[model samples]
Target chain A: NAGVTQTPKFRILKIGQSMTLQCAQDMNHNYMYWYRQDPGMGLKLIYYSVGAGITDKGEVPNGYNVSRSTTEDFPLRLELAAPSQTSVYFCASSLSGGDTEAFFGQGTRLTVV
Target chain B: TQLLEQSPQFLSIQEGENLTVYCNSSSVFSSLQWYRQEPGEGPVLLVTVVTGGEVKKLKRLTFQFGDARKDSSLHITAAQPGDTGLYLCAGGRNNLFFGTGTRLTVIP
Candidate 1:
């Protein structure tokens, strides 16, 4: 089913640069999320989408933006990358929000200098 | 903010040894989930405990949700090198709140 897929497994960006982290899921999930994992820390949610055209902020949503134009895609945009943004980013999806197991992507390792 | 804290941030054990990791929180959860993440990969679901005091097993791994629904424990029996990875506990309400993760390394 390909489950969840993220593009550009690894990337490095300069300060003030911008880019988009692409995520797509084939599972037909209604809930999608973007999370970043710092060293020795748990995954922190950046943004999430309940369905197409419906988005919300999560625990750590600063310095990032997200848009859900279709049911299968939710992309996170970094307008001006900063060194603090260096971390591993993961995309996940689930059939519903609560009490459901989420399927995660392989993760994208991003480094901002 | 609903936070989940994991104990024994890191563990190094020899083969065939036993180990236990904990996750605690001050707020109640409707359900809790456990996931294992290997190097260079995202976390994979291990199990989910929905009811208070519930116990579920996956082969050599045992998971128990506290009766108060605010804590959980994961125990591994006769650990093997293949068991080495980062363990994370997530509490679910309207959304899932992840714990700081317990890193386990089992040496051969």
Candidate 2:
């Protein structure tokens, strides 16, 4: 089974352009997260969803939005693509919050020009 | 407030050398995890350490959780070129907080 899947493995955007990154999981996990990794930097949490219709911000939430309408899907939206936002974005899912292993998707490499 | 910090942000060594990476935090966690990520890919889970003072070994890699559950370390013995990558340590909170990450390059 495909544990977690993300679309548009790579993308290039211009300033002020917008796009959505799609993420889906087949494991039926109740928790999903969005994170961004800068060059030689650690992954920073952007947003998280505990379950359907529940979303919360993490450390870095600016310039991004997320919605979880179904348990299997969580999409992250970039409203205004900026060069600073250019990084590798990752989608992850976990059965629950604490002390649980997270399954991660390959990731989306986005570049803002 | 970044809760986790890793040392030796960049490390380069020759094959068969030994190296250690450290992760430190002021917050106590229930568990800690280690992950390795290749270029252009998401991080992959290497191992998880639970319980204070727990130690786990996988092949030539060894992971240790501090007795107070506030820190951890990863040691690689006789490292190979395949071990070159970004190593990240995560602490178990409501969700995992990844460390600054250690970039390791093993030269052959």
Candidate 3:
């Protein structure tokens, strides 16, 4: 079912540039999340959506915004990219919020200069 | 912040050796899961422990959940080079919270 899919596996952005990371889940999951992983560190949440038209901030949501316009799509936007934003970004989704297993996308490697 | 602490942030061992990685927390969790991630890829779930004191085995890997649901452990017996990856432990809620990963490298 292509559990989850993320676009632009790799991206290089200059400081101050804006871009949107695309994520789509085919599993009809009610919850979707965006997380960024630094080298050797655990993942930090960026943003999450519980359902279409509902969004919430997570642990590390600075410089990022998200919108869930459809059940299958959740997109994260970087208004003004900075060097600190460089990290491996992941997208994940689960059937529900109650202890369900989450499926992840391959990941997007982002580098900001 | 509800933090999950993981020990031995990095481990390097030779093939056929045994190793254990730990994840601990003061907060109780509904469930805990272990994942393995290779370079340039997203992490994949290895096992999930729901009930307290639950023990699950996957081939040479054994996962255990603390009775209080505040900790977990993973033991790999006779490790192989293919086992090298980032081992992450996650405590489950409405959303999963991950601990600082333990990177394991099994040298051949």
Candidate 4:
């Protein structure tokens, strides 16, 4: 089913630059999320969507934005990237919001200088 | 912002050795999950515990959820090189707050 697919496996951006990390899932999941992992830190959620056109902020939502125009796509936009934004970003999706399994993409390794 | 806190951030063990890592939190959750992430890859779900004091086993790995639903523990028996990775514990449903994680290295 291709599970979850992420684009631009790696990216490098300069300070004040902007970019978007693209994510898509063919599983028809109702819930999608964007998370960043720094070294020893497991993962911090940046944003999430319960369904199309519905988004919410998570534990660490600063410096990032997301949109869910469709259930298959949830893109994270980084505006004015900073060094602190350099990390491995992952996109995940699950069938529902509770108790079900969430599938993840390989992740996009981003570096901001 | 990280509600779950894991202990012994790092651990190295010889093949066939046994070890345990813990995840603790002050907030209660409806359910908790365990995930293992290999180097250079995203995490995959290992198991989930929905009921307090629930215990679930997957191969050589044993997972236990606290009676109060605020903590969890993961134990590995006769560890192997393939078991080396980062283990994370998460709580909540929609938000899914994750722990700092425990990185394990198993050497042959």
The most accurate candidate by DockQ is: 1
Lowest-scoring 10 consecutive residues by lDDT in candidate 2 chain B? B89-98
lDDT of candidate model 3 versus the reference:
0.91
In model 1, the runs with Cα more than 4 Å from the true position are: none
Question: What is each model's TM-score for chain A?
Answer: 0.98, 0.98, 0.98, 0.98
Q: Residues A44-86, candidate 3, lDDT per residue (tens digit)?
A: 8778788999998878999999999999999999999999999
Q: Taking the tens digit of each residue's C-alpha lDDT, what string does model 1 give over B1-108?
A: 678999999999999999999999999998999999998889999999999999999999999999999999999999999999999998665466689999999999
lDDT of 4 by residue, A65-93 (tens): 99999999999999999999999999999
Ranking by DockQ: 1, 2, 4, 3
Specify the poorest-scoring 10-residue window by lDDT in model 1 chain B. Answer: B90-99
What residue pairs clash in candidate 2, if any at all? Answer: none
- Summarize candidate 2's per-residue lDDT along A1-113 as a digit string, tens digits: 99999998999999999999999999999999999998889999999898999998888999999999999999999998999999999999989884688889999999999
Fnat, model 2, is 0.62
How many clashes does the backbone of model 2 have? 0
**TM-score quality measure for candidate 4:** 0.97
How much lDDT does each candidate structure score?
A: 0.92, 0.92, 0.91, 0.91
True contacts kept of 4: 0.60
